[model samples]
Every structure is written in structure tokens, then in C-alpha cells.
Target chain A: MKLAYYPGCVSRSTGKEMDVSTRIVCAALGIALQELEDWNCCGATHVPSELVSVGLAARNLAQTDLPIMTSCSICYSNLRSAALTMEDPQVRAKVNAVLTKKYSGAQIRHALDVILEVLEKNDELITVPLKDLKVAPYYGCLLTRPRGGIDQPEFPTILEKLIKTLAAEPLDFRLKTFCCGGPIFMPQEQAAEDIAFLILKEAKKAGAEVIVTVCPLCHLMLDAKQKALEQRYGEKIGIPVLYVTQLVGIALGLNPDELGLEMNAVSPMPVVEKVYEKMAEEA
Target chain B: MAADEEFKQEVLRLAGPEVLTCIQCGTCSASCPTAHLMKPSIRRLVKHCLEGKKEEALRNETIWLCTSCQLCTVRCPRGIRPKAVVTALKELAEREKIKGKDQAYEELFQRQIKDYGRIAEILLSGEFMFVFPQGALQSMELGLEMAPKGKIKLAVEKIRGRDEVRRIMEELGKG
Candidate 1:
């Protein structure tokens, strides 16, 4: 399966490892990824003006005729939202007036969607299952939102199904689709930390050893800001955040380097080590 | 209540007429995770927008605080998207020159996109730090932590077709 991959800004920079693992997983699954020739930033969460956000996203959409696959959920949201926005005749005309080419509808798929579809097709490909690892699937806010969105916002089962397919225990946490306080992370540290704390606390209470996500922004909030979250809340909730593909890569017996496990802010080694130990014991 | 025709029409154009469907059920406030942190709360902001309190609605810090999470939008029984309304109000605020903390990041993002056609997180943060040293000092711990991992890039790599992006933006009258 060949898809036009859009690895948003985060995956290219701070979240490079996420991008790397996504590529590794896709290759292992025999999927060909053709990156957009020259994609720009999606204007992220805080676009200065509505036109700028729509224009930037439209420019990227114009680059590909194929369905767009994204590593970051925000990129998925922005691109998807932009494509949906262009459906309005007036908005389409207005946006086309500013662009050299007219933007049209493009199917936007998250990395998880691609992963799940692949897993469904080839269940026997999993040689090494992630045994005994309790995973909490964190949807953050963007992945499944803005009415008529890509997935079920209230109860997303895609990640849970993927975790179970990997033979890992998927914990049903209350905060699966909760806000990880992404936009406020930069401006309002306290508010961001508080929201992160709530997520971490709930995941820990649910006995999840690691939190897996598809959004780079959620990974940053839950993984990078964990130490700060612990300090602010004065509690040791040491759950590591891993990209969904990282967990899939591990299950497919891919090398740790290929999965970019070490690049994660909170080390996922402890969780990986436990999974390996459980596998050995079962053997 | 005097209706701010301009504000209401602009919001309706960008965000859709769903804003008028708000029944003031406070579901948005209840659904919002950061409503407590917001000054006027999202419900109040919607009310102010309806009442044509243009200056008050656009200038509020709450307008910029929205994470665009869209929880309020999904949870609202009226099918109104408060998140998009917030974005619409934010655009208005930016046009009116009502500066907020988020504007700093927005300006930095716009500049980076215009210059390179893509954002290098490392360079963007460095530029952000240079622009707001105080904020940098506060987030110094994260910088120190990520430094050892060699994650931060010291150089900027311009995208191949950056000129095309610039031309498009210029066509849009943004340049």
C-alpha cells in the first residue's frame, strides 16, 4: 500500500523518533510511503489568522493527489479540517482565489489507521508479541474531535484494538479521549501541567505501565512534561509515553534503534524490558 | 443588546452559523477542561459575542487560551463548534492588534513558515527563547534535559520548494 505521508513539523524535529519508528513500521509491513514533495507547517494549534491556517494547509493538500497519511494527530486535524472547510462553495472559491491550484477533498489517515488496517490484513505477521504490558491508549483532543471527525471522539477503540493485536493488555482508562492540555503547554505551564497530571494520575490508577499515542503533541505533553508533572503534583507517576507505532514496531520484532525507543523523553526501556521478561517466562 | 454585526458575520462566515445555535446550556463550560483557568469561561465569551460585546470578546485572554481541543464542540448538544468560534475571535483579536502570549508564538510560527516553508522545532524554540528570555529561563529545565540527547539542531535547513510557498502566501496578500 503506497500512501502520501505527511510527517508534520513535530515529527521532523522534536519528535523525529516518532517519524523514524513510523517509517520503520510501515516498511516492515510492506507499505510504501511517498512523502509530500515540499510540505509546509500546518500553522499548528494557534494560527495567526484563519486564512493563513487554511492557506498553509491548502498548499500542502495541493501537493498530493493521493490520500494523505499523517504521523501527528494535529496535522491530521488541520489537514482534515481544511479539506472539510473547502467543501463549502464560498470557502472553496475564496481559497481558490488565493491559490494557484484549486484545493479539493483529500482523505486524511492517521498513522494508527494505517497500522490498524495493516494488522487486520496480516495478523500472523506478529512474531514477537508485546506480552504482559498494560497499555493505555491516549487520544488527546485532536485525534477524534470537531464533529463529524475521523474517529469516535467519545470512545475510540482503534488504539485499544491495536494494543490487543500486539498481545498487550489494553487498559480501559477513563481519560482515553481526555485533553492532554496541548495548546496551553507553551503559554500556561501551570494549566498544562495540571491537565497532564490528571491524565498521568488516571493512567497510573488504572494500572497502565505505559501510555501510547498517535499525536506528537500528546507524546510531548505526556512524555516530556512528565517529570515536571510529577514535581507540580508532587507524585511519582512514572508511566512512559510511547508512540503507537513504537509499540507495534516492538511487537513486530524490530530493533530498538529502528523504533527510536531511546529518543523518548521518559525511557520506555523499563516497559520493554518487562515485556521481554514476560515473553521469556512464557516461553 | 446591541448586536455587533461585523463580529457576528465574520464569525459566522469562518466558523459557520452554529454559533447562533448555542442555547447557553453551559455544556461547553462543563465539557471544557481548562474553563476554570479561563477568565470569563467559554460560555460567557459566547454570550458576550452574541451581545455584540466585540471589544470585550476579542480582547479577553480567554480568547487566546483555547487549546482548540474541540471538546466543547463535540459535547455541545446544539452542534455548535465553540473551538472554531474561539479561533474566529482570535483572528479578530489579531486584526485588532490585541496582543496575547499566544500571538508571540503565532508570529514566530508565521515567520518560520514564511522563511523556510517548514518549521525546525529546535530553531523555532531557539528563536522563541531569544525573543522571550524570561519564558526560556522558565523552560530551561526542559532545554537542559533535551540537550544531552542531541535533539536540538543548531542549523536551519530550508525546504526545497520554499519559494513556491512564498509565492502562494504572497498571492494571498500575506507577504
Candidate 2:
């Protein structure tokens, strides 16, 4: 059950909570996460050079014989894309020419898949059955994209299914697969906010008590930039945005601090308190 | 038109020829979350490229506006990767040295890749905000908000194999 964990830049820094929660949740599920030693950036499509992006991702891919698992969707896509790019022997040779360790390619998995597989095998892992908590599963564009993967690219049910397994209600969110404007956060700031607002407004309109995000960048858009979105739009969309792992950790009866619940900018305290209240009422 | 055709061929090489299968259904523009913000929507970007308006396709800022969400790529009836097309266009623009915030951000990002092998949120973003004054004020306000929550930090972490990343970056500096 060992996974070569690739915590992308956001998870390591701005989204540190995601890394913490992912580690704790995996450990609780008896999944030993061996972090890739001295992993480089995934290059995240921002780097001008595609070879650099693929090479950097390939560098991390080479570090493991074990399947790679990452929390960030961008990192996941970049790694998988790099693996696909390296499928060309010519491309691999070109990339490997500069590498300290040669990487042909490696299988990469998302933390969602890992956690979902574990929970599907045994439901008892969900100690805190989020009981009737209406959740909006926000896939936010990148999670189920770039074509041909585990979930339906447009109408993904992975997040919904995961929420259902937690004894929570997954709202029929129409905008689940919409963009959170993570890539253009700086370049097109207003447009990015507008895009995130659309998703948030839709989740709110769908009657979601909490919005669950699989990617850290989505969390950054929906959770971190939420307050600014409200101020600009003149709306009180205070719905809690929790990392999917944070929710899973809560359902596993893990401590809030261990999950880095407090580090969330929007304060998933409401979800945290509700978990305790649900526990109390059940008691 | 000949020049535009040459540009289109380059785009085909970079993004893949599937983009030529685009039927101009506007599905890409429709599915695009930020198409409204782009001067020429992704559909129009395709049309311009197909029609051989190289400037409209390459330098119109629409490519830079892409979030790379790939919704259009998934939803395109022709299965065209609009994001790739846009990325290819973006790469072309950078080659042309089209100056703007997007290039600024890219340069900022590349520097991070060179130095630490990873992007430090604060340094990359901080320098970007410093150079590009367009949206920095509000973004800085957001940064200030994130500061006290321990959500962000000022430190930039360096990877153990920094020299290797620098080497790879140097080796690929041509493209």
C-alpha cells in the first residue's frame, strides 16, 4: 500500500493543509506514502519550455518504481502528460539526455483514486458518517480532464460517489466540472474571480452546506479568494470549502489539527463543529 | 495569407493536427469559462488561424487568458485540444516576445524553476505583482489576508538537486 507521494508546489506552500490531510488520511487507511525524495516542480504549464515541464515531471517520475500519487490536479495532469510525452522513445531519449536518472515513464494516480479505492473496499473506515451533510462536489475543470481517464471528463461522478460513501449527501452540482480559473489567477485576475464566482454561486444555489474540492488550486479559488469574490460581487456566499481529504479525515474521526483544518483560509470550522455536533447528536 | 498558412502549419505541428478538424461549432467558446473575457473567443481563435489571420490567432491575448481547464478539449465534437492550440499559440507569442502580464508571469515562473526547481508562491507572485501593476493592488490585499491565517509564508524552499534543474533549464533554453 506504499505510494510515491508528489506534493506539488501549492500543496507544499499555499495549500500546506492539503499535504497534511492527505498524509494523515492515507496513513489512517494503512497506505504508506513515501514522498519522492528531492522532487522538482511539475512545471504546471507555466514554464515556457514544454521539455522543461515534461523533464521536471519526468525527473520525479524516475524517482519511483511505485505508482505516483499527487493531490494537485495540475501536477497530476502534468505528470501524466509527461508520461504520455515520454511514450515516444525519441522524446524519452531527448529528455533523458539531460537527466541525472533516466525516466521512461511511470504510472501516476490521484489521491482521490487511492482514498476512493480504500473506502470502497471497506466502509468502516468512515468513522464519522457525515450524516445528511449536503456537499457540492467541485471537480473544478482539471480533475477529470485532458481526455481518457478514470472518470467521465464532463460529468464526473467520482466526487459525488466519494461524498455519498462518507454518509454525506452530494448535491447535484451542475457546475462540478467547471473551471476555477486557477491557471489565470494572476494574468486574468478579474476573469478568474468571475469564473470562480460562477461555480460558487452555483454551489450555493444548489443548497450545498459545504463545497468539497479535489485540487488545491480549486480550493485556492473557491476557499482562499472566496472573501474577495463576495466583496466584489456583493454577495454572502460563505459556504465552507474543504479539501476532499479534509472531509475524509473528518469522517475517519481524525483530529482537526492533524488534518490542518485550521490552516484553511475560509475556516472550515463550521464543518468541523458540525462533525462534533453530529457526533454529539448520535451519542 | 501565405505567412498565416505557415503560422497555422507551425501550430498544427505544436498542438497536433486534430485542431484542424475543428468545425467552428463554437462549442469551445461556449464551454470556455473565460471566453467572454477573451477578445477573440477560442472558436474565433480557431477560425482566425484556419482563415490565416496570424496576429489574431497568436497575439490577441486570448491564448494567455486560457486557464487550461481543458473543458473545451473534452467537449469538442471534433476532439480538438483547444487548450493545446491556445498553448501552442501562447508559445508562438512568447517566441515573438509579445510583452504583457502573461509573459511577465511566465518569466517569473521560469526564474523559480531555475532557482529552486519549484515555484515559491510568495517570490514568484510577489515579483509578478511588483512588475505588473494592473491587478497587483487587489491581489496584494488578498496576500495580506492570507498572511495571518498561516495559509501562506514568505520562505522559498530550495530542492536538493537545484543544480540539476538549472542544468535541464539551461539545456532547454533554446525553446
Q: C-alpha displacement of A229 in model 1, angstroms?
A: 2.1
> Which model scores highest in DockQ?
2
- Residues B1-175 of candidate 1: C-alpha lDDT, one tens digit per residue: 4778877777777677878878899999988888888989999898888777887788777876677888898888988888878987876776788765677777777778889988877777667776667667536766665666656666776787677667655565341
Q: Which stretches of candidate 2 lie over 4 Å from their true place?
A: B173-175
List clash counts for every candidate, in order.
0, 0
Cα error, candidate 2, residue B143 (Å): 2.1
lDDT of 2 by residue, B1-175 (tens): 4557788887887778887888889998998888787888889988887777888787777888888888888888997888878877777887898888888898889888889887888777778877787778767766876777686777888898998898887785454
Indicate the TM-score of model 2: 0.96
**What local lDDT score does residue B76 receive in model 2, on the 0 to 100 scale?**
89
Number of clashes in model 1?
0
Docking class of 1: medium
**Candidate 2 residue-wise lDDT at B152:** 72
Q: On residues A179-199, what C-alpha lDDT tens digit does candidate 1 reach at each position?
A: 888776766766777887899
Q: Please name the candidate that would achieve the greatest lDDT relative to the true structure.
A: 2
* Candidate 1 docking DockQ: 0.55
